[model samples]
Target: MYAVIRVRGRTGIKKNIADNLNMLNLTRISHATVIPETPSYDGMLQKGKDYITWGEISEDTLKELISVRGRLPGDKRVTDEYVKENTDYDSVDALATAIFNQETTMKDAGLKPIFRLNPPRKGYEGTKKPYTEGGSLGYRSENINELIEKMI
Candidate 1:
């Protein structure tokens, strides 16, 4: 799965990008959402590329994210036994693997689709430019996990 994090806010954003962000369910700063890796999602990410950063999420990071930020229905924390009883997966990693493979989504696992995160402790270099330009937008591949860790 891919993790998409909103880098910028909703001021001065164009209509199309705003709509794309809404479809991605990222209306707040420091919010994140996991989506399957597919052509449709690829286009959505690109549509909001200027306002977000995305990348392939690692299994370890997925586990950490779920343990720390994942919330069940009614805002409960996700526990190992809860995952086992509520879903077929035995562990967070297994569920993450399944989601990574597009067998299930965050919804299927009984977890909240949106992850509310803290702004990176050190702050971003710039939200106006791409990752390759020493900024915080666009794709960062495995480095996205590093960013998530800081925010978590």
Candidate 2:
């Protein structure tokens, strides 16, 4: 799966890019969503590339993200007990494994789809430029895990 995070604000955004980000459920800066890797999602990510960052998420990062940021319907922190009670998984780690393996989704696992993250610890390097140029926008490949760690 690809972990996508909105990096820019809505002001001055073009309608189509805004629509793409909205469709991805990234309506605000620092908001993130995980999506299966697919052609349509790729197109959407490309459309909003100037205002977001994304890449394949590592299982360890994904697990930490879920354990630290995952929430339930009533804004409760997701725990192993909750996972056992609400889903087939016996622990949060198992759920994370399942999600990483594409065997389940956050929604199906009874977690909220959107993860509201704090801005990266040291903030972005440069939000206006692409990741290839030492900026925080655009795809960052496995470096996305480092970024996520900072945010978490």
Candidate 3:
């Protein structure tokens, strides 16, 4: 799975890019969503590259994200009991594993699709430039995990 986070706001955004962001469910700055890796997703990410950052997500980070930020329909925290009661998984860890393995999605697991994250603790490197240029946008490979850690 890939973790995609919106880094910029909507001001001065082109309609096509805004539509891509909306379709990715990253409607606001600092919001994040996990999606399966696919060519279609790659295309969308490319189209909105200037306003977002993404990369393959690690299982550990995915677990931590689910345990800490995953929420139920009523805005309740996900617990082992909840997972046991509602799904085949035994706990949040199992759910995270399933998600990482592409066996299921956050929505299928009964959690909100979007993770509302705080801005990174130390702030971004630069929102206007690509990650290759030491900015916070575009792809960052494994470095995305570090950013997620700070945001979480």
Candidate 3 structure quality by residue, lDDT tens digits, 1-152? 89999999999999988998999999999999999989999999999999999998999999999999989988899999999999999999999999999999888888999999999998999999999998999999899999999999
Model 2 residue 87 CA deviation (Å) reads 0.7
In model 3, the clashing pairs are none
Best by TM-score: 3
* TM values, all candidates: 0.93, 0.97, 0.98
lDDT of the candidates, in the order given: 0.90, 0.92, 0.94
lDDT of 1: 0.90
Superpose all Cα atoms of candidate 2 onto the true structure and report the RMSD in Å to 1 decimal: 0.8
Give the runs in model 3 whose Cα sits over 4 Å from its true position. none
lDDT of candidate 2 over 1-152, digit per residue (tens): 99999999999999988988999999999998889999999999998999999999999989999999999999999998889998999999999999999999998997889898999998899989999998999998888988888998
At residue 140, what lDDT does model 3 achieve?
A: 90
Residue 88 miss distance in model 1 (angstroms): 1.2
Model 1 C-alpha lDDT per residue in residues 64-109, reported as the tens digit of each score = 8888998888989888899899899998778877877778889878
Q: Model 1, residue 139: displacement in angstroms?
A: 1.5
User: Which pairs in model 1 have colliding backbones?
Assistant: none
- What's the distance in Å from true for residue 15, model 1? 2.1
User: Best-fitting candidate, measured by lDDT?
Assistant: 3
